[model samples]
Target: MPDWKTTYAHFLDTAKTAYTANEQRGDLLVQGELALAKVTVDVASNDITNIEREEELTLYFQMKQLLNILRAIYNDQFDMQPEKEDALVAAVLYFVSPFDAIPDDAPLGLFDDAQVIDFVHEQLASDIDRFHHEM
Candidate 1:
């Protein structure tokens, strides 16, 4: 397997590039958010009951939590520095991009997305804590 940390780092850069594109970034993120929603629904409908791995469950939860946090930021329910905000947006946008470190169609495809979210959460731990506390 490839180095997830490095791969996720590249994802952040890609996401930042897209986010810096203004209106197009908004459209891309919307598409990503919708894709995440669809995946959430699919998991709830079938795979939720079948998921037996602890790691998988943890990743899924992180994906949901970070996405929620990202939504709060976008909705103005939370605040973050522009750089961190851009990173957060980039992490979320990974959901819509098919050409990522790991193909979204492969087994455990979302592993990369979840890891990126976790890394962002760690890097912005205080900001996330503030978001939780302020909300």
Candidate 2:
């Protein structure tokens, strides 16, 4: 796998994967983006050094861009499946909470995202019962 920069660039460059993934559920794109956003937040909250301002700033910018992409994907996907929109939104919010296995101020900033993404992917792939349960 390439570095995070390359991987990030690749993901930012296209919507094809999301489009294809959403064909069945029609909301996979939004769910994916929501999942990404939640994961990004998890990563961001784990900054350990107050002195490494540059790194934090870079991450913040990346987070902003990722958030925009997620909003777009979510909005588009949400329009297609209004029935489960509420549930999807709830799940995204659930993951966005300031709670994770690691403290937000840990040295490994992006660690939480990996775990969160795995969970999000699982949830998004499964039924809506879990989402509704959160409500």
Candidate 3:
């Protein structure tokens, strides 16, 4: 298998491009909702322990924040532009996706998900802060 770092970099680049290009698509909200649902299920199913075992408490908190951001967006509480919405949705999709830089079943598989969540949080920092403040 390829080095995880390299694979993760590639996934990030590809995801950014795809999400940015499709930012104006009509079905972006639907896609985001579906991805959020999957992530929520995973969260409810004790998947969070993976991160806890990995000792990435910061990432664990970021994941919860990311989920809240998505939930706000889905609930129409956040008035984001189409492009921003698309980017946010793409990030969620990346986190929920099983076939990522490292397969989710692999050892420490959630490391990639945590990385994605961290990246997304950084990218959407202002929006996240605003959402939290407004809530």
TM-score of each: 0.71, 0.30, 0.60
Q: Among all windows of ten consecutive residues in candidate 1, which has the lowest summed lDDT?
A: 46-55
- Per-residue C-alpha lDDT of model 3 across residues 44-106, encoded as one tens digit per residue: 576567655444556556766766666666566767766566556655666556777777777
Score residue 132 of candidate 1 by CA lDDT. 71
Tens digits of per-residue lDDT for model 1, 1-135: 566666666767776675664465557656766776756565656454465345455655666666667667656677678888777777766656666778878877776766776787687889877867887
Which wins on lDDT, candidate 1 or candidate 2? Answer: 1
* Ten contiguous residues with the weakest lDDT in model 3: 20-29
Cα distance off (Å), candidate 2, residue 68: 0.3
lDDT for model 1, please. Answer: 0.67
Model 2 backbone overlap count: 1
Indicate whether candidate 2 or candidate 3 has the larger TM-score.
Answer: 3
Give the per-residue lDDT of model 2 (tens digit) for 1-135. 244334333332333333234342335434545555544454466444554444444444433333343454444632324323333333333234333444444555444433433433344443333323432
Off-target runs (Cα >4 Å) in candidate 2 are 1-51, 77-95, 105-135
Task: Say which prediction, candidate 1 or candidate 2, comes out ahead on TM-score.
Answer: 1
Misplaced by over 4 Å in model 3 are 1-54
Q: Give the TM-score of candidate 1.
A: 0.71
Residue 93 alpha-carbon offset, candidate 2, angstroms: 7.0
